[model samples]
Target: MILTRRAMLIGATTTLAGCDRIGSNARFREALFSAENFHKWAQRSLMTRDAMAREFRPDQISPIFRANGTANPNTPEYKALWRGDFADWRLRVDGLVTRPLSLSLAQLHSLPHREQITRHDCVEGWSAIGQWRGVPLKTILDGAGLRSQARYIVFHCADRMGTGRPYYESIDLTDAFHPQTLLAFALNDRPLSVANGAPLRLRVERQLGYKQAKYLMRIEAVQHLSGIGAGKGGYWEDHANYDWYAGI
Candidate 1:
């Protein structure tokens, strides 16, 4: 039988709650992440891969869209961008494309854009509604003439967790081109704040908040993920054994 969204999320939470135990045992760690992969595979098998997550009316916008992960990217480069109001910031998109792009915030804003009011669901068990405005990720990918061989899109972010490793995330092309996937620069009708991933952030609407990587610095389309950090496709996946395909 197909599981409800709540049921799926609850199961994920239960799995996450036991991560420490899994981490302590090498065999168990493998088993746990293996199960996470199966969870992702099962969800894809049972549900439409491109189904949109629930969107909400503007009235439902949360008064406080609590920031998840890296409120402020303390790196010198990020600090400089924040001080200059991101006037010099550019998002680099390269790899496995006929054309590469280095786009500034203004350039991104000039492109055809989309606005959506969507719910942000965190793995830590909180949800918030917010209006996000940005260009669809596919718009950028298409503009770059994404190569047919490209299988995954990786995000390199500026934020570093306490462990001092930089944040990173990846998604398969299926999610990369999803209608609701955005490279959002604005939230709630205003410029995004430092506490909320200023400059740019990802919005993979169907996934949980952690998959919505913040402080995006670069996007690379690659044929495979084996060369990326730890070959697991993301920071948390490499460090905490969080599912690489965090489909919500």
Candidate 2:
């Protein structure tokens, strides 16, 4: 019998609840991780690459968008940028591009941007709606001149996990160029707060909130995920066995 995406997500929820016990069994952990590949394949096969997530009107935006993950990165490097109001901050776009870019906050703001109100669904089973404004990731990719071989875009963020490793996430070029995918600099028409990924954050609307990497320091286009953390494509996925393909 075939399971729908909804069914799979429900199953994932149950699986996650027992994950601590599952992690204790090495064989069980390996089996679950192996199944993640099939899960990714099934999701991509069932949904079109460009299938849009539902968008809402401004009136639908949530009054208090709850901050997730790192509310405030206490690292010295991140603190310096926050202190200077990110004037010296630069978002480096490199790897598998003909023209690598190092865009400043001012330059990013000057670029063409798209604004939309969309729902953010978290793996923790919560949701919120917010207005996000930023350059469509495609615009940046185009400027960087993506090479034909480029397959995925990896977001390297400033926040570190408890283990002190930098946070990161990856999405395929299909999602990278999707209409709703953005490098958001503003939330609710205001400069992003430090608690909510100041400077810039990723908004891949079709995926879960964990995939929405925040406080981006670099964007790299690569053909493979092998060199990334644990070769699973994300920090949480590497450390906590979160599904690498976190589409909801």
How far out, in Å, is residue 220 in model 2? 0.7
lDDT per residue, candidate 2, 127-188, as tens digits?
99999999999999999999999999999999998898999999998899999999999999
Candidate 1 lDDT, 138-187, residue by residue in tens: 99999999888999999999889888989999999889999999999999
Write down the lDDT of every candidate, Cα atoms only: 0.90, 0.92
How big is the positional error of residue 8 in model 1, measured in Å on the Cα after superposition? 31
User: TM-scores of all models?
Assistant: 0.88, 0.87
